[model samples]
Target chain A: AQSVTQLDSQVPVFEEAPVELRCNYSSSVSVYLFWYVQYPNQGLQLLLKYLSGSTLVKGINGFEAEFNKSQTSFHLRKPSVHISDTAEYFCAVSSLGGYQKVTFGTGTKLQVIP
Target chain B: EAGVTQFPSHSVIEKGQTVTLRCDPISGHDNLYWYRRVMGKEIKFLLHFVKESKQDESGMPNNRFLAERTGGTYSTLKVQPAELEDSGVYFCASSQPGRREAFFGQGTRLTVV
Candidate 1:
């Protein structure tokens, strides 16, 4: 079984300030990590993923995440924020042993205040 | 390359009414999936299909939910006598074989009154 956790339900930050959205997962087997963003009324868009080699992955819209195996975490970060970056971010995990079903986190809504 | 597309972007029906959601996945992608998010909760897996075959449906909530993928093409999920608890955003995703990432649709917002 695989599960994902996003502790913050909502995060408010000032424009140009850095922000972080935390994510953690638990699984008995190897897994793949992903971060997706959904703007208002938009579909879920893939931000980045950590599959094999790199622990740190960069995504679109100036976002990035690091995969920490020992910590069982994949936290998303942005050095600076923009008003257009306000959206709901989801953390997901899928098993590496051909289990296609993905478990998602509750999501964190980022509100960028100007 | 077209992304996954879902029909009836929004629907509102009375309780006990039937509703069917449609999803057209990306071309040549044999893997399709269905998930739902209710009341701002986590997205829950519903089912998965591999070329007209029901690969896994362990996450289906109940028997009232019937999903069909005829001819390995588009898929439809029908809820007979939908209850208020079934109201949520239904998402459709598709990915190619051997790929881990899936592309999602805009989702169908179902409202049961």
Candidate 2:
């Protein structure tokens, strides 16, 4: 069994300020973690993913996430924010092998205020 | 290359009405999947199709939902007598054989009144 949690429903940050969205997961077996961003009226875009090797993975639009196995967490962070960055972010997980279904959190809405 | 495409981006129908949503995935992608996000709920997987065959449909809510992929190219999801609880955004995605990553469509927002 696998599950993901994103405590914050919404996070408001000012322009150019650093922000972090926390995500935690629980899985019985080895897993793959991913973060996706969905803009208004747009599809979910891949922000980043952690399959193996590096614990810290960087993604598009300057968004990066660090995978901490011991803590069972993959938190996304960005040093600066822009108006265009306002969107909903999702954290998803899937078991390591085969064509498994992904489990997703409720998602966090990021409101970047200029 | 074109990304996944879904038709009738938004639809509002009365309860007991039937609706069909369509999807056109990227060319040559063998793995296609469907997911739905109900109001205030997390997105959940509905089903997956490998070409013209149903690979996994354990997430399908009920028999009211029917999915088919003709010739392994385009797919359609038909909902018969949709209920109010069925109102949500339906998403379609496709990936290569390995399932490394999947590309998503904009989603079809269905409102069953």
Candidate 3:
């Protein structure tokens, strides 16, 4: 069984400040990590994914995340956030063993204060 | 280029009533999935379909729910005698075979009154 834990339930930051959403996972086999964002009353949109290759993965809207194998963490970061970036973010993981069952975190709501 | 689409953005039904939700996936996406999120709960997977074939349905709650994907295009989920616990946001996602990322629909919010 695989599970994900998002440390913070809500995060408040200035409009131009950097933000980080921490995520950790527990899995018996190798896993693929992903970050998704959802606006109010909207479905989730994929931000970035760490399948393989480079640990640092860049995504749309100037967001990025680093996959740390030693720490079992995949934290999303953005150098500067805008009001448009305020949304609920979710961290998810899927095992490489063809389980195909993606496990998601509870979700962290990012509140951008102008 | 259209994303997944679902019918009846919101529904209010009494207990013991039957409801059927529809989903139209993106063109040519063979893999379809069903997931739901109850109040204050994380989203949970219900089932998966690969071109009308059941890939995995281990997450289905019970026999009260039935899902079908005919013609390998659109899908439907039927709930018979829905209980109050069945109230939640139902999401439909679709993706191409072997693709990792799945596109989601706006979702159907079911309220069991």
Candidate 4:
């Protein structure tokens, strides 16, 4: 079984400021990591994922995440954020291979202010 | 392409009542999944369906919850004798068999009052 932990429950940042959302995981075997964003009253949309290969993975909307195997972390980062970036972000993990159940973190609410 | 969609975006029922939620996965998607998020909790997987066959159902809370996917296209989840703990958003997601990404639906918010 795999579990994901997103440390920050909420992060408030000024518009145009860089931000980092921390995520950590615990799994017995190799796993896949994912980041999803959800707007109010909407479903979650995939932002980025780390399946294999490179440690650094870039995703849509100028967001990126790095998979640090040693630390068991996959942290999402953005150089600069806009007010539109305000949303709830979640980190999830699933075991490698086939279709498996995904475990999600508690979620982090990003509030971008002007 | 049309994304995953769920019917009756919001449903309200009293405790001990019964409610059904529906989901339509993206066309041609072979893997469908059911997940839910209770108040102040993270989303949790309930089950998985590969076509009309259930691949995994370990996450199902109890027998009071029933899920069915007929003809391998759309799926339905039913909660009988719903409890106050069942109040939350139920989400449906789908992906290709080997695809790493799973597309999610808007979800059906079930409120047990």
Candidate 5:
């Protein structure tokens, strides 16, 4: 079984400030990592994914995440945030296989203030 | 292309009542999954369907929950004798073969009183 841990439950940042949401995972086998964001009253949208290759992956909305295999971490980062970036973020992990169930962390609520 | 969609954005029912939630995956997606978040817990997978067949159901909490995807098009999850612990957000997601990311629905918020 795979599990994900999001260290922070909530993070508050001023508009235009940089932010990083920490995530770590535990799994016996190789896994795939993903970051998803859910805006107010909206569905979960894929921020980015790390399937293989380049540890650093860029995503929409100027967000990016670095996959550190040794540290078992996939932290999401943004150089500058906007008020519209306020949302709930989730870190998920899935085993490397067909139709494997994805496991999500407790989630981190990002509040971007003006 | 249309994204995964769930019906009844919010449902409030009394304990011991039955509730049915529906999900319609994308047009060509063959893989459908059901997941839920109870209270402050993380979202957990309930089941997965490949077309009309149930590929996996290990995450289903109990026998009171039944899910069916007829003809591999749309899916329905029926919960009988709902309990307070069952109140949460139920999300539906879909993905096609060779796709790494699963598109998610807005989810249905269920409250049991």
Candidate 6:
């Protein structure tokens, strides 16, 4: 079974402040990792994914994440946040094969305080 | 190109009522998935369809829930006699074969009172 754990349920940060949302996962086999963001009343939008190659991945809206293998973590970060960045973030995992099922975390609500 | 689309963005019904949600995936995408997020819970996978065939349904809660992808184009998920526990946001996603990323729809918010 593949499962994703988003450590924080809510995060508050001032505008232009740096922030990080932690995520961890456990899987018996090789897996793919992804981060998605959802604005109020909207569906999930892909931010970034870690399928192969570099451990550091860059995504839209000045967001990025690092995949730490030993720690089993995929933490999302942003150097400076904007009020528009306030949204719910989710970490997801899937097996490393074609048509694999994707599992998602509980989600972290990022509240950007202007 | 258009993204995935789902209908009845919000629905409210009493317990034991029936509801059917619809989804239209992006054109040419062969993979469609169903997921749900209950109150204060993570989004959980419900099923996957590949070109009108069910690929995986291990996450389906029970027989009360049924999903179908007719003609490999649009899909529908029906919940019969829904319980209070079934209230949540239902999301539909789609991706082309061999793609790692899946695009999501706006989702159907079902409120079972």
Candidate 3 residue-wise lDDT, B7-76, digit = tens? 9899999999999999999999999999998987778889999999889999889999999999899999
True-structure Cα RMSD, model 5? 0.7
- Candidates 1 onward: DockQ, in order: 0.90, 0.81, 0.72, 0.81, 0.86, 0.86
The parts of candidate 2 lying over 4 Å away from their true place are none
RMSD of each: 0.6, 0.7, 0.9, 0.8, 0.7, 0.8
lDDT of every predicted structure (CA atoms): 0.96, 0.94, 0.93, 0.95, 0.95, 0.95
lDDT of 1 by residue, A1-114 (tens): 899999999999999999999999999999999998999999999999999998999999999999999999999999999999999999999998865989999999999999
**lDDT (Cα, tens digit) per residue for candidate 1, span B1-113:** 78999998999999999999999999988999999999879999999999999999998999989999999999999999899999999999999998998999999999999
In model 1, pairs of residues that clash are none
Q: Which of the numbered candidates is closest to the native, going by highest DockQ? A: 1
Better of 1 and 4 by TM-score: 1
Model 5, C-alpha of B22: deviation from truth (Å): 0.1
Binned by DockQ into CAPRI classes (incorrect, acceptable, medium, high), candidate 1 is: high
lDDT of 6: 0.95
| lDDT by residue (tens digit), candidate 6, A44-87 | 99999999999999999999999999999999999999999999
Candidate 2: how many backbone clashes? 0
Task: Write down the worst ten-residue block by lDDT for model 5 chain A.
Answer: A93-102
Which scores higher on lDDT, 1 or 3? 1
| Candidate 5, A1-114: lDDT as tens digits | 789999899999999999999999999999999999999999999999999999999999999999999999999999999999999999999999756678999999999999
Docking class of 6: high
Q: Which ten residues in a row have the lowest lDDT in candidate 6 chain A?
A: A94-103
What is the fnat of candidate 4?
Answer: 0.76
CAPRI class assigned to model 3: medium
> Which runs in model 3 stand beyond 4 Å of their true positions?
none
lDDT of 5: 0.95
After superposition, the stretches of candidate 4 with alpha carbons farther than 4 Å from their true spots are: none
